[model samples]
Target: MSLRLFNPRVISRAALPSTSRTFIPSIRRLQDSSSDAPANPKLESIVDQIASLNLVEAADLAQLLKTKLNIQDVAMPAVAAAPAASADAAAEAEEDKPKEKTIFSVKLESIDQTAKAKVIKEVKALNPTMNLVEAKKFVESAPQVLKEGLTKEDAEKLQKALEAAGAKIVLE
Candidate 1:
């Protein structure tokens, strides 16, 4: 419950192999704490005493305390196993669920009589390989697929652009 601060004179080189350079003159010096001390003076004393001890002394103290308190070293695998099990269950759930449709087709359903020119221009812009005349012909041929095997996002974008240009379009 309390940390016993070791006296350098009493605890010589033969006592414990402490490579710590921390030095406090006497027990009275620790008892007369500075203004920096927290609400709990006992905690400050324990902290100061622990700070003075080296690695070996601290490890020895921890091991002795663990044994005395009957504390067991629990394996990390027990805690980690839960997430891994849930991940496996999630993978299985995905496998059981229906597969999503990614591929789509953009179809030109119809064109407004007044916006025929605009629709032709949009078609030409969408297809760089096609000439002006060919794009015009492509526009005239309504209810035809503009592009096939496109991703859903690409199909939707194409549909929106054509619809904006006064062409009735549908994504399949």
Candidate 2:
């Protein structure tokens, strides 16, 4: 290998090669040179100074170097963590349940005088404002209401109508 002498103090005027393979051609030339080049005094002094420092001094120096040499400290924007539930969600849940019927299932025998107590019992079970004739009418209608079966909803409506109609001749 032929040796090419280069002045160490002078910076090269040519642009450094862009590729990784050619990044340090000057270093490669020194390696190929026959004459020994003195180790860089500045680099040697810096390395020796770092090695000599105590732990606290080394940490402070490192922090200073980082502050001076750092290129970027950009922060990325954060995304919303969770989507909120809408007001319509509660209404949707309520709509899913089966609506209770307003009818009642009652037996026919409760209308008879002997079974009057049972009629009163069933009437008060659904509504406390029930009186004798209203109870009787409700009991008498039991056959028709129970013909195909009645929901609690229908029974409640009939009971209200009977109560509103007031006292009447249940047997006659």
Candidate 3:
């Protein structure tokens, strides 16, 4: 059966026999590749020349050359191991430290009186147990519609009527 890249499943269902392809490299291919290594003739000659320099000259050159070249730098894998191990050990050590807990308490009281009672009832209906000053403020700030929703003249009459009965009204 023919191979169709997009429909490989159809080929499998067709039950075609499989073929074994063997791969083998010739002698010419084996002889073609060479190892890669750098040959720095200039650096080698400089090292040889430095070794021949007198002690005083070498000391002066060494002082001048601080950090200019590093011949035996440590590999990163070796350098990184110590810090990682120490960090792990530090985390383990910190878990053993004792922790402290804190708690608190509060007390509250309610007061009752007459002129304040009406105000308290209104305030409590809107929001429970409002402070005395807040209740007074609420009464003072209440709207006209809320207070009575009457004309100026009618409001005056109502106020007079309420006063006659020893009552006070606050408008929204």
- List the candidates' TM-scores in order: 0.44, 0.24, 0.19
The candidate that achieves the highest TM-score relative to the unseen native structure: 1
Clashing pairs in 1: none
What is the C-alpha local distance difference test score of candidate 1? 0.85
| Total clashing pairs for each candidate | 0, 10, 4
All models: lDDT? 0.85, 0.56, 0.50
The TM-score obtained by model 2 is: 0.24
Per residue, candidate 2 scores C-alpha lDDT tens digits across 1-172 of 9997777446453533467336577677867664676667999898899999999999898788778998455686543443234335656777997776553453342244564565456565555677777765666665434222566556455554444433122210
lDDT of 1 by residue, 83-111 (tens): 98878888999999999889998999999
Q: Against the true structure, what is every candidate's RMSD?
A: 17.2, 22.8, 19.9
Pairs of residues at least 3 apart in sequence or in different chains that clash in candidate 3: 142-171, 142-172, 143-171, 143-172
Considering every candidate listed, which one attains the maximal lDDT? 1
Higher-scoring candidate on lDDT, 1 or 2: 1
Candidate number that wins on lDDT, 1 or 3: 1
